[model samples]
Target: MTFKYDVIVVGAGHAGCEAACAAANLGSKTLLITMDMNKIAQMSCNPAIGGIAKGQIVREIDALGGNTGIVTDKTAIQFRMLNRSKGPAMWSPRAQSDREKFIHTWREIIENTDNLYLWQDSVKELVIKNNTVTGVLTNMDVQFSAKSVVITSGTFMNGLIHIGKTQLRGGRISEPASYGITEQLSELGITVGRMKTGTPVRIDGRSVHFELMAEQLGENDFHKFSYLDFEPRKLKQQSCWATYTNEEVHRILRQGLPDSPLFNGQIKSIGPRYCPSIETKIVTFPDKTEHQLFLEPEGETTREFYLNGFSSSLPLEIQLNALQKIPAFKDIQIYRPGYAIEYDYFDPTQLLHNLETKKIKNLFFAGQVNGTTGYEEAAGQGIIAGINAHINCHGGNPFILARNEAYIGVLIDDLVTKGVDEPYRMFTSRAEYRILLRQDDADMRLTEKSYNLGLASTQRHSLLIEKKEHINHLIEFAKNYSVKPQYINSGLEQLGTSPLKQGIKLIDLILRPQLSISKIAELIPALHKEIDKIKNRKDEIIEATEIRIKYEGYIDREKMIADKISRLENIRIKGKFDYNSIKQLSTEARQKLDKIDPETIAQAARIPGISPSDINILLVLSGR
Candidate 1:
């Protein structure tokens, strides 16, 4: 009655895709089970990927040999480097993808990958024996056996959709709700809660009044997501529009408040804090007269556009009435009304740093099912879970990433340590060593580690080695070369900086905030000649060398601090500790410790109610 696999990955969304790819790529016989094969890797909401800290996670996934960055680059219609004016640590690469093509690209890669298989079915229950998961039971009464299982159910578990006063059982707009698994998991004593997220309505692109909106064009220069040297196919780029909702639009939305699931108490789940619904925005930002809305094309060939900031669960007519008041959408014809979905999510604190369940051996969870809220976040967890599942199946050490190592590390640590009361989204401020975890350096950070783990490919490692050599050579060249005083004064004077009175090393000149390697090339004939040699990789080499020179002090300082705190992380707190029996710990610490079972002393220190005194007591007790 059972078929076999080394790993069984449930759900074929971003998280599931990466997990299956990672496991399969690592030589595990993996089976990817999904509700609909046609919907694999579908962008359930916006048709874009990466932003701010989110972009760093995607690149980290790519560095670790995951398919997201490769798929994104291949299907990208528009690419932009966000926060370029800021420091290199803040610069993130974002791409507007052809949603249809993104999925197709992911599916093709998976199909061609070694040791991976696809099954179309809903997983209803886990085949459990003792305290570990042996496999999953599908809706068709088919049992598939695996040594380890990873569930990346996303928002499809026990999903409920809300449209004003009308409600329906659905995962997405037209997709049916998935059931049985949540109830079954709860029966196994997993702590579960409801989390809500919503999407904006789609409009016929031809119906939009484009003349009234601000045209946000793509940058002329493109930066790709993958560290691989392959060139992605160039697609004709489309422009996105920016518009705002005024007081009039707010008034119209307010009128529909009574019917809103967000306001009418129809949905009690906590929605994403950063990406609030339009209805919530109206009430939360009452004094603000307007809110920005981005109109993004859903696909390269499709005429439908997603109204980015206008997510609402009000009645269909209410959404239409409100849209009609906006200047650009006065005659907007909606393809669908925005709706809120409430789905079951497990508290991520129940998971280990490797994403395996603490309660169930050989079982892991990722993505929205773990209360995270972005595609990049999900993909990051997916690859980690997949790697650990495969390692566990083969009786190897678990793979883990620490906070200072990568953005993916920060995400997993935050979720498992602090847990989420509301849907968690990544922000640059959340990372303490952001200076060390720059998106530009993701390959240098994780590719070797992934390669050692058998997750990253040899070609990825070779490319990384070549890139680092170029960067090092350029850095050494800049440090040794001297710039003539007269060579940079003209450029310096224009930037309002004092002209150089004496010759200085090129690295020193490049370190000045007002001067850049590329800018100085316009003045110094020698520098220009040297830059031309970098050729196709000139911009990338310059960026890497500049950041290393400018941020050397900050990066080293963070590394020292990270090294100190890493000692605390190294001191593990036993999960089986009977916190209740520890009288020296405070009442609140005892309760929190017992509940979270913090994996390390550093993680224990981060809990809300736990204090320095509590950590001191734990250190004394654990003999650290």
Candidate 2:
């Protein structure tokens, strides 16, 4: 059987969802093919979304009209803004989600989309002709034709799961491994490598002694993930409990370390260094007598609790013993034992900045298949890949986000240029222009671009324009409007900040380290009145104005640096450029350049062993 679609997206995880939505929403007849329809957008590991730098990527996704942030808001059981004590740039929004609800909501949204269709089958092979992807072959030998394909296979390709000495062919606990595609791609001369990731076990929440664990509650005043500002759902919130593992727990884990696939010669793949398993942690941090374990509820109603920070592939008996030794988990019943899984992924250096495979036109890759590890990171890349695929079919220039513009840009740039050896994760430190790429102003930075691409709705575009206007109006009012010593000095003094020495503009005072626009609104009635008049939406106006004033200098400096680097980025190279012909280039640089096939001079500069001399030679060759 043969079917045709304008765009075909493989996998129904976060990345596939975004890619399907983006293409479908942008008028492509899109089909989202997956192994299991029921597991669409399933939180296979943690039942949470957004953290640290990951939150900014979610906001950016929201700005670009992706469904992740909106879906997260709808399913969240608890909400918190992490790093609130730090500067606004570091403040990130996080939400604990109802896992079942999250997946159900995602499926509902995808089903409701106009041009999107769903197929329940594993993609077995890519039907490529003339060095471009034409379609995909399903498990049942059905040919699904499309002009472009976005592969977000996400740990299912040749997956192998380990539980102590026993091993199985599966993606997660029960999901079967996908086959044929890896071998087919290898035949196409694409390089593939294995990477391992593990999830923590689930335990009976009722069995844990709550009295011995510290309660970790959500923030009193929560911020929603979406910029759309949909009415917040009123649901009973759930709290997660925190306890620590004692030396006894470590001892139990140590007993099973010899059989661990990670430690033994069984597993050759590299796991995420930052998110190590329990055995690795115990072995690496030997001096530490205790390690924290968070007991997070799977849902508001479910008795199941995810055992965070205790990921392992130890024997079931050993895992139970380790859990029993934890402070509050003495009588805990195991729901599932933690296990490690290794899967195939392509090196992202094989992809261009547009997320299209360098070896094959109109074939794009995103999410875990591209070596990225987070839902938000995957979703962000999916949106970009979807947009670029649509553009590619329509004969338009590929859309690329600059590093200074959004975190998504930094993520994709890092992936395509730097080629991760292990599972890649996004962090604030990765972006030099992070101050300017604040989560608070993602709509301001990216909504217009989305609008131009037709991904953003007219109403969203209008709202973004109106929001910018409101911000400018408020900035002007704050700069010109002054508050007297009597009206604000008393409140300012109470905040441990200095009192107004003289009549000061509200904007000038807000620029101080301690004072905030919200505080100013609370103190002076006139200022509050002015703020209310200019800002119809308090959250957007406050966050946007605060970031603008607070980090203005750093933002400006980063922008200048970004501009200089962007010049190098603009120096494009022909796809057939000869790296071996350059005598002045180092042997290592030549090999690395050939491997990565960087599209620009700036990308070449970021490679590990490439030097200034190699870059200069490329610059001369490109006539820059």
Candidate 3:
């Protein structure tokens, strides 16, 4: 029997889960198909979520009514705000989650979401008609019809696992590789490429000598990934341990290099440059004497620990020997050896910014299947794909994010515009408007947008408005409140800042590099009274206020620049001209323009090899 739905999402990893949820929540009848129900939204690589720019992506996803941030906050066993010493734009929230609980939590949510249904099956083929995807064909011979199909196949498509000279056909350690889909898409004239990524070994925490390693503790602050406040972390917090590989450890790894699959001419796919395997690290940075590794807890109750920076694909014995050389790991015992996996990915340039495939109508791709490496990156793309798929089915404009608006925008724009030569990872440096994309204000930037699209709930929009009112009130108070030298002079001296020479506006004191809103509140009773008015979300309000007051100039400057550049974005170019026939354009420009078919002049400018002269020519042709 054939089942029908408004949307069908293939694979239940981070991307698939978000895509299915977004579509269903937007009133579409959606089905989420996965190889195994128990492993929905599995943290296949790191047990943690969010880091650097990835944390920003998670917040944007949350603001846009996605479940990843909520799930992350609920299951978090340890939470830390990274790069606190730097500017607020650099600050990112990262959490180590209860792995088993994370999966269970996601399963519960997916099961309960309105209009969403889950099927335990592997999709082997797409049921397409006239370049439009109608549904999927499962390996069990069941055909499911859908108006739109989102394929978030992750690392499962034609996956090959490598460890030393040993190779296996699997998506993950014990999971079987998915077949047929990649070949079918390739036969349909879609461009397919290979990418490689690796995970580190799981260690027995009981065998670890924690005393020999430096302990890194988690902070119990008000900060979390989700904007909506939840009850404080319920799981018992755990500390991660840091250790380093010594000369001896490096020696052992070097001795096994010949047997490593990464080096033995076995794996040819390009891997993530930023998150290279342990073997690659040693070879690339040979002059270095040591490399630091973090031992993180896999769950609250489990004794399993994951080695953060020690990814490898060496022989099992070689991996064990290399770790055993480190003092904390002198008697190391691993649950399994780390292995590198290569999988098939479609060229992301074949996708629209909304994640819809350029070749197939109503077909979308996200996550590793689109050449991205992180779970956060995958989820960000998933939410957009889900939103656009719903729009494609119903009557609405396709959803797209601009680079100046979000890190998710930057990620999608980069993927579809430039394409990926290796596994793409998110970094703060990747975003040109990161100042406008801080973790503290994702809700400010995206909640209303999602709410307008009927994705974010009314409650979320109300919360965002409330938070903004509180922040604006606080900023107004700081601007008007005056502080006398007597009131803050002595306190300023104690804090190592120069004493105030005369009375000043509280905002002036707040602008001081050494003074914070919290510190000012401690010094001035009137300011403190005004701050107390915001009792509902005191810390969040104060932090957001501080960022606004402190970086007002920078924020305004970036917005002005973003607005100026956005003018080019308003120029429509897609299907506007036959670029190949435009003899005035360079050969390379003609080919790239005709290939990418950029939607706007701004997007065309961002495309590699497209020069200023080409853009001017296009502008002239368009009578700009």
Candidate 4:
């Protein structure tokens, strides 16, 4: 049978879920095809969402009307704000989720979304005509036609799983790997490569010695991923246990090195450098005697535990022996041994900033297929791809974020400008304008843009306006309110800050490193009254106000720098140049320019092989 739709999304993982939802929500007839309908938005690796720079990406996704953050909040088993001791920019919100619940929640959303249809099948090939995707042909001999296609085929594109000397043809354990799509794309002149990633073993919680390990509990606070005013986190909270692998464990791992697929010639693909296997860690950090590991709960009710920082592709015997050395895991009973999987990914440089391929019109690639390694990164790309696919089918300007604007911006630009040599993962240091991209203000940065595009709902925009009003009022009050020396001096001295010589504005007191608005509000009745006026999102408002007052100078400086660079971004240069004919440009610069075909002067400047002099030459040639 033949089916028709506006958009067809292959693979129903994190990226696919976001892509399908965004398109469907935007008034498109979207079909989400998956091999298993029950496993939509599956947490194939860790059961947690958001970490380090990843948390910021989740917030950005939420702000842009994506469902990841909302689903994450609803099913969270534990919530923790990472890097709390650091500055506000470094602070990120992470959550351990009920894995099964997460999948169910996403499936429910997919099934209920308007204009969205779900089909349980694997996409085998693309139906292309004259360098444009028409639809997809599934393995079931069903043909579905669409104006645009988004392939979020995560680790299932010709996936090969390895454990010790055994090799399996699967996307995940027991799940069959997909085929034909890669060969067809490769035949169409797209550059494809392989990358490997692994997950750790799942242990039966009853077998673990809880008394021997240090307990790590989640923070109890108003912090969450979504900016909408709601009581987040519905699941029961759980605690994670901290443990470490000692010299004995390393010795056992070393003994299994000969048979390990990662070390042996069985696995040839490049793995994520940041999240390496346990064997790789031992080999890389030989001088270090121990490594910390965490025993995290998979769900609120399930007794299954995920062993973080212990990923391996070693033989089952070796893995078991190594676990026996750790005190908390002396009686460890694992459901299955960890294994590594290698999958095919397209070179992201072959795609435009909007995630549409340069070779195939109306074709988009996202998630691991773009060589990104985290759930947050994939969702970030998915939302963009979905939005652009809708635009491609209908009529609208393509949505693209800048590097200084968001971590999502930085992630995509990094992918297309300088393609990955290893599996890419998001980190705080990767973003140059991180201070401006804080998790605290993702709504301020992205919500209005998505709202203007008719994706973010009216309720979300109203909430943003309300939050802004509260923040502005609070900031203005802090700036105007004066603190008398006698009233605040005692409190200031007790707090280890210097005593005030005279009256000062409350904003000045908040600028001090040791003082916070919450602490100062305790001393003054008027200030507390003003703060109390904000009934909903009180803590969030106060925190936003405090961050603005404290980091005002840094924020302004970064904005100035970003504004200056943004001028170069304004210069249109996509179809204006035949770079190979420009004799003044460096040979490598010409090749890179002709190959990647950058859209702006700033984007051209960001390409690795393009030097400063080459940029000057281009500016001169463009009549700058």
TM-score of each: 0.97, 0.97, 0.99, 0.98
- The deviation in Å at residue 291 for candidate 3 is 0.7
How well is each residue in 120-194 modelled by candidate 4, as lDDT tens digits? 999999999999999999999999999999999999999998888989999999999999999999999999999
Model 4 CA deviation exceeding 4 Å by range:
none
Summarize candidate 1's per-residue lDDT along 9-108 as a digit string, tens digits: 9999999999999999999999999988888999999998999999999999999999899888888877788998888889988889999888888889
Q: What lDDT is obtained when candidate 1 is compared to the true structure?
A: 0.89
Backbone clash pairs for candidate 1 read none
In model 3, what lDDT does residue 12 have?
Answer: 97
Please, what is the whole-model Cα lDDT of each candidate in the order they appear? 0.89, 0.88, 0.93, 0.94
Q: How many clashes in candidate 3?
A: 0
Error of 3 at 376 (Å): 0.4
Tell me the tens digit of each residue's lDDT in model 3 across 337-358: 9999999999999999999999
Residue 464, candidate 2: alpha-carbon lDDT: 89
lDDT of 2 by residue, 299-352 (tens): 878988898899888888889988888768888887889999999999898898
Candidate 4 to truth, TM: 0.98
Task: State the local distance difference test value for candidate 4.
Answer: 0.94
Candidate 4 Cα RMSD (Å): 1.1
